[model samples]
Target: MSAAEAEAAAGSEYPAHYKVMLEKLNEQRQLDQFTDITLIVDGHQFRAHKAVLAACSQFFYKFFQDFTQEPLVEIEGVSNTAFSQLMDFTYTATLAVAGEDEAFDVWKAAEYLQMQEAIKALNKKIDEFSSLAARSTSKKRKIAETSNVITETLPTVEGEHVEIQVMGEGAIEVEESGAGGSRRRCKKCSGIVRRLRFSSSR
Candidate 1:
């Protein structure tokens, strides 16, 4: 696979928690049903949950903490586009910022809002989507440069058969283990493989 494709695939493997958060964010956006506060930016209105905005942005956090009643807020000196992306990032923890200009715009808004999480996420996405050839060291090389490590096991028992799978850096082995287990070894002893078995009594 191409370096860009590999990098994208690696980056897309976000933790399960992030997946859940993203799903909830998208669901909220789709409903657009529980917004308790409105933000007025560049003469446009945006409905959002105060808790979400306060959680993701220190600026909003302090503002909300001090004000007992603020149903509407007016932001100054931020473009509608940048604010939109910032809102999206605050809810989903993902940024769609593309070119340097777009990145800079959203970054400025994030900085103004004191949203550190959004800033870090934007930087990571920017790096991940950059041209693979533009960097001095290839991502593939970086990933491959890690010390030889093999740590994975998949065992399954179905009916009268036992199947085991061992995965390593550059190799994988699938073996069948019945009542009597099976042993597999590499010629160079590059990895450790364990046998799995199922009793015949069942």
Candidate 2:
């Protein structure tokens, strides 16, 4: 792929929301060094560094708490619980949201939190959508290409000849004349007409 195309593809693979989260985390990092920050969810408090906290929003923390059903541990610096919560939130958001924008946002939040599972899941979902769109586009292109009319005339023995006209998506019409008389075929496999030709009148 060209550089532009590769960049575009990479952008598509990383959901928009995920990208935002990464930006936010980077911004937070620049503002302050990584320091423990407390997060409150469901009457419970969890501790993580400023970097991690900035990467994860309240929505993700709550989602993770609900999923774990247990009080998360507070590590000295960055907490594993925080990471787990981020991943759970991302997966949940992607599954719950109807809009691609929302899904992307949640994916980004997860990515900012440095949740591997969430990033992988988001990538997979994006890939699936991309594949579906490509297939649809391919089908449309094929339909357009096959809809044109193609006509061909072939010479035969004893002043007889055949004129073939193909129409529709894949329909073929053949008019043949010889000592045996004229014959016509429509989209049928004709072993006799081995060497078929096509041309555009327009």
Candidate 3:
């Protein structure tokens, strides 16, 4: 069999079953009991297991290596949302964000924290979003032509008028006149944020 198949098979073996135990540990970590360290972000305190962080990140390993008596570590540069996502991964080995913008933010925070695994996971999601954007552009053009209508498209990344939308189970639809709008869903948890582009006459 191929190397990928071999790896998958190995993952199905005994040691991989231990992930269930790790997941339970993660649930307890969330409760903030018996936590050895606290990460302070945006003036908010998040309790953490030092051993878990050190095992996952060399940066944390070096930071904790000095082993000073301090129990709280303050982190700056990363927003509270991104830091929380990082902790989510640190605990459950899962990476999730609301949308491309949030994913980028989390990836940058992962870089700052020197968490290679999280960086890789976010990179894969970034690539998926990029591909989706390309497909969307082509699909939009065809739809506009078939409808014989003039369509206007506007792209906004960050702006004052930004609005957030929650979508139902079917395909996502956004009105063109409404500028600076975003829709985010998580499929595994719900539905992940796919880009929402609207078509209308300006």
Candidate 4:
């Protein structure tokens, strides 16, 4: 048949997860829901002879970015107390005005710990704030043909003491008078026109 159909058929012939890493990734996705182990890049969790609590704190801090308010490390699975300390330490460290090096260190630790969301946010912030040119180019561009309409009021003498006013764009005619109230009509379709009132007085 067609080339596109042939390519689609060929693609469906192969089995998914053909690579070893892909199989491991799928297994990790399954085990991630059940695992209690705290994996971090650095800071003694992986260190030999360190207390389990200390290692857990290091792992949580490094992976999760901040651990100050969290009870993650001491929970039964990961221990909520250790997690709290890690979170606290991370928050305090991140807030320090003079701790750029420490922040970078912690980021590295988090990266090593495989804290995916923290790594992504930190990287995004860095990229966004690093260059003025990049930041300027990232601004959204607005489309034309969408803008405010300017209405002009024209007064006409209708009767002895009544005055008529016409307003709005050339496509629509909105006629109003002190005695007759208001009337609207579309120039192109001859349809009845509707007047919309603004909420603000100004």
Q: Which of the numbered candidates is closest to the native, going by highest lDDT?
A: 3
Name the regions of candidate 3 deviating beyond 4 angstroms.
1-12, 142-202
Candidate 1's residue-wise lDDT over 81-187, tens digit each? 89989988777766777665677667767766778898777666555545433343455556778544332221222234323333333322223224776444322
Residue pairs in collision within model 3: 185-191, 185-192, 186-190, 186-191, 186-192, 187-190, 187-191, 187-192
Candidate 3 or 2, higher lDDT: 3
| lDDT at residue 201 of model 4 (Cα atoms) | 21
Tens-place lDDT per residue, model 4, 1-202, is 9999998877763445345534553355334433333322111121111222234334434423433322212111222223332343332322221233333444443443344444444454444444433334344222343344333222221221212122233343223223665444433312222221112122
lDDT string, candidate 3, 15-101, tens digits: 766788778778779777678776656545567888888877777787678554456555655677898898888878887786777
What TM-scores do the predictions have?
A: 0.53, 0.28, 0.62, 0.21
Query: Measured by TM-score, how close is model 4 to the native structure?
Result: 0.21
Give the alpha-carbon lDDT of every model.
0.61, 0.42, 0.64, 0.33
Those runs of model 2 whose alpha carbons end farther than 4 Å from true positions after fitting are 1-94, 146-202
Ranking by TM-score: 3, 1, 2, 4
| Highest TM-score model number | 3
Tell me the lDDT of candidate 4.
Answer: 0.33
Model 2: lDDT to the true structure: 0.42
